[model samples]
Target chain A: MKQLVRTIVLSDSYAQSSQNSPELEERDPYNRLLARQRGIRLPAELIRDNALTVSGLLNPEIGGRSVKPYQPAGYYQHLNFPRRKYAEDLNENQYRRGLYTHWQRTFLHPSMKAFDAPAREECTMVRESSSTPLQALVLLNDPSFVEAAKALAAESEDILDMFERALTRRPTAAEVAVLEELLASEESRFAADAEAVGQLLGVGMKGVSADQRSQLAAKTSVARGILNLQETITRY
Target chain B: MNPYFLDHLKRRTFLENSFTGIGAVALAGLLGRQESLGAPSGIPEAKSGTGILGEKRHRPVKVKRVIHLCMAGGQSHLESFDYKPKLAELDGKPMPASFTKGQQLAQLQKQAGKLKCMGPQFEFTKSGKSGQEISNVFPHLQKVADEIAIIRSMQTEQINHDPAHTFMNTGSIIPGRPSMGAWVNYGIGSEAEDLPGYVVLTSEGGGQGQPISSRQWSSGWLPSQYQGVQFQSKGDAVHYVANPPGVSRDAQGELVDSVNKMNRLFGKTRHDPEIEGRIAQYEMAFKMQASVPGLMDVSAEKPETLERYGCQPGDGSYAANCLLARRLAERGVRFIQLYHRGWDHHGGIKANFEKTANLVDQGTAALIRDLKDRGMLEDTLIIFGGEFGRTPMAQGSGRDHHINAFSMFLCGGGVNGGVTHGATDELGYAAMEDPVHVHDLHATMLHLLGIDHLRLTYRFQGRDFRLTDVFGHLIKPVLA
Candidate 1:
């Protein structure tokens, strides 16, 4: 097994002598294809083959709403996008396209700036060393983080129900007690000011405060509870 | 250790069986340990590998902080710092074919008419006792000319916006390396425990000239904590930083205590390094929720300061960002990078270039004066320049990108004042003597900060990396 592992490693590097060659391209397609792949559907498909082109995902007419990609960005150029008229939605007047003509060689992505995506340049393997207190803070309090967490939780709720369905034997008394304690805490927190918040909004509160700071201190305490619940930051 | 294979030892005594089983398991454990240890060398030590958490710098530094006023796009050397008399002699004449040798031109070349070498659109006069010939365009910067070190031969690797911006910010023309600000944060952690070490500010015309993005101030291989925290000059600088609903500050504290308790238990079991970072960040975030909003508020500033930086109290602009940078510097932010973009005056050379210069020059001079008044100038280093310079020859009426040579100004800290360390050719086409590449400039800046560029390294991908990246030399002439 050791010798086989060594052989595999050697052959892999030998086959991929150049990191960005056709060999590696053939070997990995699905992993490299993000969001626009089989599962998570992208509204428009950006063809990366040669010319920068944007094609619609649906049939050419009905849901096949596609517009031509905008011009590539130049040095010191204003990042502006073209406007499109849609009869159905007044808000769909303009949308900004990416900077590259399809991932230009050394240029940065505008979306990467809008969304802080790591620009992998110097090395292939980036080490995620945990040192600063900012990372967790940003995750807990950054509005972007709050939105992502809520979206992720909502999507994974169905999977959580599936975990409950697959159970052949009920949990032990201790396990049941632990879950009950968590639910009880959530209930108590909700009871504290749900009515007050609802009154401010001129409606009764439907749920506990979704504010992350309220949950900021509770994130880690409930992280295990969350991970053990069924889905681990994943939909399935 | 395969249990099925051990079963074949029928003749083995009970004691022998016990000994052999234990030995087999121990051997297996040893092999597994090596596999786990196979990760590349220890997390990169400090460049010199002498201090705890990379705190030991190359020397005892005088500069406690740095505020780099990055002029994005291309700030014209001709109109601002570099004064060329020969351009007047060759005004509207064709650029000699000999001068065009091997030079690639941006769209400006195709549009340039008969190589019109227009002289300074604005007048140039000697400023202060140093007799530095600064253009009238920078009336304010001229006041501090005696305290500035202007390097007219400063050059870069690229002419285009994205690459040049990336090269200036990070060491490489490519993205993903730690930015200079991030490196400073990594080398010298933070004086303030609650706030971030590095902070970024931008001017209102959208910090146009330089490409200001997360990559410009990213921590890269270093932990994300070292990354610059961007605080806008307008409207609650950081988004979603407001306190959540229904949670009193005390209630929030209680929740944090509960989370920390659980984390302590999990950390003991898993020994995850990130777990500790998370705990620290959570506490910092809680504290930041109170401090950050206060820090960004400028309503308390005296009217004089507001007029000095040309800042509108509630508006976000370059002038506002410049003043905010000073505030952050006072608050102990190790590195404050300000990007004021829109300097590329390719079309309306006279009209556009002059306008952009007016926008920056006054505010920049005010920052220097403000720092000096506060007694922070002595220990605070300030850098002002763009990625590269505009061409010596005309591109139509406007100048194109000239990477061969340009100008940059350094003031305060340990830089020698009233000096121009290098020179460009007669036409200012290229560096004639004492050529300083971006790497060399980086080295010299680090040197002023008491950091040796070569020695200040972070190991990444089995090799040590640095801001200068295998090539950089401290220009001893510029140092005091």
Candidate 2:
């Protein structure tokens, strides 16, 4: 048998040649280290061969150690919503949001008509498809969507007020105009009948002595509507 | 591509161009062959819709389309169409041993009360030139009797509600199978490019029982892409298709175009049908944003036509659905299945039948008459039947489940009209002469559609399955 002598060496020149240029110098310290690790260029082909040979030597039965059933290739981090402190302690805002949470059966959560989400899950793989016009009409006229739109407009007003309180400057004329039109349209559609408005306000046709409850309810809808504005919903 | 030798080739610099061993030579040869070989016959090239399968054979003699009206639950034949005077004579008497001997019992009275013979609850009179006996419950159907081909000896395998409904809709006692509409859709690819080939419309607002489920229109074993498209016909018909607030029509169009571009970018590399399907769906979605509103806009229909069918424009009623079905048929939908439940009447047979009759009789007749006047009846097939029929004997002066005998009718689509084929016994208990099984009816339906039921097969799980799986024979006597 002949014995072979092999010398392995690491050179700075080779390492420098393999290093990738940084995307930006302004990257955070943690990101910079991660970028350096990612940019380390090695001959993957040679590394793979050496790995196989080393693995084969360590576990001689076949080649390398077999994967166990319990060990996964990678871990997945799940996103979860924060829990409320108490079930009965929910305010009107929280209650309204919860009630508006739609139980969408076949597709993504339908945001109010103002958001323009798809009606159902669209299967992309097959050529054949069908959709009814009624869906579009429904979205245009549904009371649920109308209420959501109104809430969104009111939310914008609240935001503008908050901005004035914090920044001490009013929202631009363009922004205010858009918000006003949205609010007006929503208000007009919702005010189709005075009886309906009375019902929503939770008040009787005849004035009652303790009418503060009805006034509060009516005010809450406007506040909630302001909260539901596109500006409020979208992350600008 | 050759994993074994390629693994060694990458590491062995000395063996780069040298064919040192039989393994290297063999592997290289295999890799070369793999790249050069063309696609097999089973899988067709993408984008060319023709390749998924062979071109569907549509015989010139075949009926163009079908509109099936399934009255869910059992419709009492004696109270509706199959008027038996003999049952009137045997009223209040226990069914003689001669009558009850060979029949299968679905349910025992549980309380051990003797079954009493019941006569027709409503008066039956001869109507039309053919003098077909129709009960007063279906005055409108009686008017169109001459144009109808009634089959009074219809029998199905199952007796229970769910299974019987399943058997009638899917040709099997099992819950999952391609429905008759699905089968028709598969046989003929589709006529309308925008709409689905098979459509289901149901009116569940004022019915007595549960509405027909989407399962009845499922394309089981076939791709979910082939399932029947359901139309609610009222309110917002499609779910979630409204435009966003402040988004103009042009802006929405641009957004759809952007989405379509993204789809095309992802779809270009792979030959997946799903990606292709997505591309097609986007185009439809954009067009539907305009067409669907127009399609459901029944204001174009004249006031007289609406009055004839007794339909309201936006109300989601069965009568409106019938009018919609005719419109869909005109739009070239291959198959339309309409279901109206609540025919199961064990008591107040007269009143219940009258209610059901009033709800559907005029609308159904109007559909046929309208189709005929428009010259669509020649190409469109019409079929009306229930899951099964009710018993002749009264279970408290009414009827119980009877799956052994029933009545169903078909018209137009080259069928011999003004004729009654097959018959029930004098008491309407069992299929006595020219018996037509549910399988046979399925076979006949496919036959009318220009498909050879035996030949139309879809291979699944290494076995060929058909609409008339393992059984069926077309009744030639009913064909013109």
Candidate 3:
């Protein structure tokens, strides 16, 4: 199964753009006849796994048991029988594959839930692929995503280098300009309020050093936006 | 090919083959196209902040919103609403052979082995100007007794909890069907762009309330977008509603804008509708960041108001959820469902029912009062009931699951208040009057919301599926 997945993903068809001819679209819009490769969103597990892999935080161990990553507080109060309380595995466990994240049958992790993970309470034949405001929320605020951006920012101080490290391509000039503007704005904002910057750095499992906080914050912001780019989450 | 295998109709194949369903067909016809260019992923998106479907009411809407308070483990009609005085007289006696004739009892015959009549575990007294009979276990609900339409003969096909719940929620005894809330949202698009069209909040108290599966809120074959968005009472009202701890709102905003820019660029190149869906979702998430906090912060209400519903801010109590449901309705959520678990009492109905009842009664009553006070009641439909009723026969100290007949109550603008629309026999065992099946209840709710139950259909697998399935009556007397 692993080999099959790798070969399919590494194939030319997998790398083809979802962009296609209107004539083909008019003929087989759903690509039901396999007229062209379709651009589909990454699955819930792949999304997080992609982030962790790109961030260099991924611990690629073969799965054995479920691992708990940091999630929003009080997520499982909806389930009872001895109400559940999530305990974070902040070590290598937190950095494991997204598929390894512990899935409580009643309440899946919030990050997984936001990205359309099935609760697995019943046999799910086809997982529903959906886009919701919740996904944006998760991308912007989830610790895993944020930390991945932080690690990408830490990968290099050069913004262009960071882009290549994260997306594997030099960003277009226009995309670079967008990041530069965001970095300049974030730099001034954080410089003005060091305490606020400190507060931001204090959130999740790891914190960066204080001396380069503002630069790192700005880079982190740019990296976050890059990570959220459609191509980053899209295979093609 | 074997007939069953020949036309098995893999769901995806069928969906892709018949791309022409609603207005997409009209658009395809108008575009000088002889062949279909595929419809936008029919992922049930609310138009802007409105709901996904782009149509108006089929009739004048008497009620524009509905709150389904699900008593998950069937709350017994004998104790809660249905008044059968003779059951008390016949307490501790084996059910008359005549009453059990040709009857199939779940748990009673399957587990307990025999059936014995159980009396009303609580006293029923007349309350309100209409003198509606209510159990002593619910003094607070009694106060609003005049505001409700109680149906005593709601029946279903399933006898077990899971199937019974699936039947009550999705109009099917099988799993993988869009829930009634999903149907309502898909048909009527939401009035609020910031919140989901349909929202589900769950609270369990009785026993481990019948295990609730996500399937209850699944959109089934409907576009996944229409599924119920379960809101949590904590850190973020929804899983990702809040920005991660360190990210500032301004930074997040900039990130979203850039992301959208990239997404739009990709969308233009591919012309995929999923990209547009993602864009809308991001915008909705941005708006939700503001709207949800304000909505979930029920602390904004006065001290007196919180006390009325017995609510605690940030607590996942049924009371807090009931208050939240009203808040959601006020904010343009088209359908809000609260699964208040722990009502199933197969044993110790006398002991466990009261505990579960107390968790919901004050809040349920307060939601109606708050809506009426705000002058929103006329447009808000309130429904309170469970998958089925508890058996009239005693087991240990409780009753088994009874699919034969149970009671449900509807209130708010369209309901004919203080009226009892159906009834059970003197023993509270079987329907003797108007039998209001789950389909009938669904039909009446749709009617109140200005939808013709027959007209609001979603075609799937060469057939149009409805919340009422192949059954449903308008329940005319249910209307005011």
Question: Which candidate wins on DockQ?
Answer: 3
Tens-place lDDT digits, model 3, residues A116-179: 6777655655555555667777887788888888887777757888777767887777777777
- Candidate achieving the largest lDDT: 3
RMSD of 2: 19.7
Q: Candidate 3 chain B, which ten residues in sequence have the lowest lDDT sum?
A: B6-15
Q: How many backbone clashes does candidate 1 have?
A: 16
Is 2 or 3 the stronger prediction by TM-score? 3
Question: How well does each candidate superpose onto the true structure, as a TM-score?
Answer: 0.68, 0.62, 0.82
True A-B contacts kept by model 2:
0.03
A1-236 in candidate 2: lDDT tens per residue?
A: 12222221243322332122223212421222323221211121222122222112111232222221110011111101232122121222221222223323332222221122323333222211212222222223233333332333223335356324322446565545543444344345434544534444331112223333333223323333332222222111
Give the better candidate number (1 or 2) by DockQ: 1
Provide fnat values for all models in the order shown. Answer: 0.18, 0.03, 0.53
TM-score of chain A of each: 0.30, 0.25, 0.87
The better-scoring model by lDDT among 1 and 3 is 3
Error of 3 at B290 (Å): 1.2
Record all residue pairs in model 3 with backbone atoms less than 3 Å apart, i.e. clashing: A141-B244, B45-B52, B46-B51, B46-B52, B49-B193, B51-B189, B51-B190, B73-B344, B206-B342
The best candidate by TM-score is: 3
lDDT of 1 at B445: 79
What does candidate 1's lDDT look like per residue over B231-336, in tens digits? 6455555543544444456555555554554444444433222334345555666667777777777778899998988868536567777887788888887888
Residue B103, candidate 1: C-alpha displacement in angstroms: 2.3
Best of the two (1, 3) by TM-score: 3
